[model samples]
Each structure stands twice: as C-alpha cells, then as structure tokens.
Target: MPAEPLATVVGLLRDKFDLALPETSTELWHGHPVWLDDDLPVAGFKAYPTFVTVLFWRGQAITDHSGKLNASGSAEMSEYKLKSVDDFDSDLFDVWLQQVRELEAA
Candidate 1:
C-alpha cells in the first residue's frame, strides 16, 4: 500500500524539481527504494513495512554538501533504509535536483 506521505513527497518532488519522474514501483538499489530518472538510476526511496526512504543520486556531485545535509537533517542517513517522512529533506534535495537539471540540459 502506498503511504500518503510518499505520494505527498512525490508530489513535492514533481512540483519543486520538475523531474520527469520515472515509473517507479517498489524498487531498490544499494538496498533502498530506487526512483529512477530517464531509464537511468537517479534517486531512490526506501519503504520499510513501516516507512519510506529517500535516496538521492549524484551523491558524489555533492561531496561538499555534508554540512548542509547534516544541519538540515539529511546527514549520515541509512544508505539502505528510511524510517520516516522527515528523512526526506527537500532543501538539501533541491541541490541534487539542480544537478539533475543541469545534467539534462548539458
């Protein structure tokens, strides 16, 4: 069953990032919800029996973003599981989103 928060978050993504979301069902990579972009892997979200995980692609692209991610509450999170909706931080996520946009443009 899809959680309300998941749909809400997906909406948040489409509204904010304009990422033409991949046809994501329950999938995993690095052991988490694999939200794909353009048939290639981009971002991911993990859904435990109880919660959802949000994983960002281009992690290497943000090598210097640890402080921002941590301060904003997106730090050192499970590279495998997300247990709360709060785990999805749009602020830090927006940066990765921008990277995706730039990559698409280029």
Candidate 2:
C-alpha cells in the first residue's frame, strides 16, 4: 500500500489506542508501536508492506464477537490486518482493547 494511506491507518489506530489505553505506556518495540501494561505487552501494531497488523498479546482470550481478529502464530496472540483506515472499526477495537487490558491485569 501507498505510504499516505498506510500512514492514515497507523494514525487512526494509534489515536484510538491512545484514547482507549490511557493507563498503558506506549513505546516502539522491535520497531513497531506497542502498548505495554506495566512493561508487559498488551497490544501493538506492526506496519507491513501490504497492511498494518494490529495485535493483541492475549487476543485468543478476548471474547471477540465481531470475529475480525485472526489467531496469530501458535500462542494466545491474535491480530487484525488493515489495508486502509476504513478497515478499522473503532467500536470493535475499543471492545478488544478493554478485554486485552483485563487479560493483562489478570
């Protein structure tokens, strides 16, 4: 994807994350933006050549009724790939973010 559209997607995701996870610290881990709860990664986003992948460290545990999150790797991680800003659903992301924070807390 083009840089402009990708930047827009990144901006949208980052904005929502900042709003939803005010208590978590934000940082660039392995070159990607990650939100950490007490130094443990709870959620993050990686920009790829084709899309931006939003990831939840304990995503498999989240009750994602929307079913947009796909299992990533062989762990509790889950992800949603966005090719554009329109692919992002703020409401769904907020729900998932809340669940992920809860998982991290536990």
Candidate 3:
C-alpha cells in the first residue's frame, strides 16, 4: 500500500484521470490501479516510495509535442513520474488522455 501522502496524490490524479475519460472504469491489475476503456487497458498508475508512475498503454503512438511523457522500456508504452500532487500537469495529462481515447476508439 502507499503512504498517506502518496495515497492522496494517487486519489487526486485518479479523480482527474477518471474525469477526463468518463467512459473508463477503474480496476486492479497486478495490484496496481488501472483504467480501462470498454475492457481494454488504456492507462494505469502505481505508487512508489519516492514517486508515482503513470503509464499510457499506447503512449508511444502519442504525439506529445510538450515532451512530458518519457520513453520507457517497451516500444508501445510511455510514462510520467510524479513526485507530488503539485507535479501533476493537468493540461498535458488531459491532452494525453484525449489522445489515448481517440486511439482506442480508432
């Protein structure tokens, strides 16, 4: 489980994420919080001792001109690290969220 502060951050981000994609539902996959669009995994969040990791399943396909999302291990995945609630970039995140929804719909 995450610490109190981290849990709060998780809650805040989760709420915003859910609001962005109102069609998505929350689920637990491998004990981490995952957001699914019509049963397809679209995004997920995992908390760590020092940071929280947010991932987009098809993030590599996103055209993130802001350069916020990091190129992670897989060729199809992209991620962002948030150390605190303040680090949560709502504008950039919303852009990515909309892109993911569009990609999934396509």
lDDT at residue 11 of model 3 (Cα atoms): 87
Query: Model 2 TM-score?
Result: 0.92
Per-model TM-score, in order, reads 0.46, 0.92, 0.89
lDDT of 1 by residue, 1-106 (tens): 3477666655554454334442333355566455555555555554546654444555444444544322123543223233445656766566656665555445
Best candidate per TM-score, number? 2
Tens digits of per-residue lDDT, candidate 3, 1-106, equal: 6786788889888888889878888999988989998898889988999899999989999999988788878568899888887888778888888899899889
lDDT to native, each model: 0.49, 0.88, 0.87
Q: Clashes in model 3: which pairs?
A: none
Off by over 4 Å in 3: none
True lDDT of residue 59, candidate 2? 89
Which residue pairs collide in model 2, if any? Answer: none
After the best TM-score superposition of candidate 2, give how far the Cα of residue 39 lies from its true spot, in angstroms: 0.8
What number of backbone clashes does candidate 3 have, counting pairs of residues 3 or more apart or in separate chains? Answer: 0
Candidate maximizing lDDT? 2
Candidate 1 wrongly placed segments (more than 4 Å) = 2-38, 67-82, 104-106
Top-down lDDT ranking: 2, 3, 1
